[model samples]
Target: MDAIERDDDDIEFVETAYANVAEFVEQLLLPTYRRNPAKHRWDPRWWEYQEVAMRLEALWRSFEYLRLEGPTGMAVFFRDYLDPTMRELTSENGPFWRLDKLGDERGVPDAWPSESPPRNMF
Candidate 1:
């Protein structure tokens, strides 16, 4: 059997940059990020889509980690994480695609179809 080593530093709790994902998106992300309406799609009611909310939360967590990495932290965060994630999130085929087409009055669109795989496939 193999054993994994645990370090005290790993267990240390670090405070997050923002109180919640919404705070991060409203205060830092949305304010700083500029998107061309013609190319990227964004819905103000982002939380309605589970996938978008999850992705935003992930981005918020990533930002919290990267912000502590010194001067180059923000640049790397933008280049490595924010750019790609935002591109995908706002892409024509992304979670918000239907919202863009159907208009905000229609509400959230149905989730993409999926089927459960055989147990223990992993």
Candidate 2:
């Protein structure tokens, strides 16, 4: 049926979006963990990062947990797909949210600090 096909496509789209978001979070957060093993694993910041990423992705597909303040459907994209606090920092050019900015605890860049990959056998 046409309805069944449409529903299936919608489900597929949601699954793909979630997968991409999860991959993005893993890539972004793993470096943080490596740079500050003691602090990140123990501190609430790590959980915050995970929570924000997960929630954002969920909202992107479902628009379930967001408050919007813009043109029709515009806020959904920003609210669901973006990190609210990080966006505040990066979108406004704030020092706390730059790729080159260092983390206060680890001295690693906010995104990726090192120019060379870690030397490993793997």
Candidate 3:
């Protein structure tokens, strides 16, 4: 049987990072949460929070670069792409969230599917 041994330290980093991200989301989304569910729209305000989450994730990914020096990488895409749009939105009394510069590259995707077959089904 092939088994995977998990490292508690890595898991701890992931857990802590996840908790931080959740807190960020909650703070940014509280306003929207107060509105009726069905009345939700693709308002600029919502996107501001989304961008903030992206930047936060990027900040977390930057930690990986610190421990592993194998490759050149940066997670500033979220800020790069969204900042201009957000700035424009906010300039005219539109909703927006000001996210710190995350850099030129965006953070990696939030989720990835397993490559292996299902357990006991293969």
Candidate 4:
């Protein structure tokens, strides 16, 4: 079943993408969460991360929440997944509609903030 295969591929792709997005969100939201594992238990996103990671719809909503929090760099996560229909959906005042249009909260560098990681670790 080619369609089944495609769905499997999508599932795997989304899972990995979700992990990257989640980690980036964590880094942005709280650079020190990793240092304090107990903080994760208090972070709503961290508490629900696993369940949402396994469900596409929930994952997308979580991503939208990230966008609202700070939309910068999110276009990368959905890059390959965007399709004509998906693009149309995002165009209609949707959470993702302005993803490309929204600037970073700081409206500064197109890159991650200095406090953001890959440089600084918790």
Across 1-122, the per-residue lDDT of candidate 3 in tens digits comes to 11112355442322232244445334532443243323222232333355545654554344333323334322242344334433443342223222222222223224447688788985
Ranking by lDDT: 1, 2, 3, 4
lDDT of 1 by residue, 5-104 (tens): 2364455457776888999999999998987777777888899889889999989888887877889998999999999999998888877776554344
58: Cα error in model 4, Å: 3.3
lDDT of 4 by residue, 54-119 (tens): 433444444444343345535643553323223333243322222233321211113335654675
> TM-score of each candidate?
0.80, 0.27, 0.22, 0.18
Evaluate model 3: give its TM-score: 0.22
For model 2, give the RMSD to the true fold. 14.5
The TM-score of predicted model 1 comes to 0.80
Number of the top TM-score candidate: 1
Residue 11 lDDT, candidate 2, scale 0-100? 26
Least accurate 10 contiguous residues by lDDT in model 1: 1-10
Clashing residue pairs, candidate 4? 90-97
Error of 3 at 60 (Å): 0.9
What lDDT does model 3 reach?
0.36
Query: Could you tell me how far off, in angstroms, the CA of residue 30 lies in candidate 4 after the best superposition?
Result: 3.5
Model 4: ten consecutive residues of lowest lDDT: 102-111
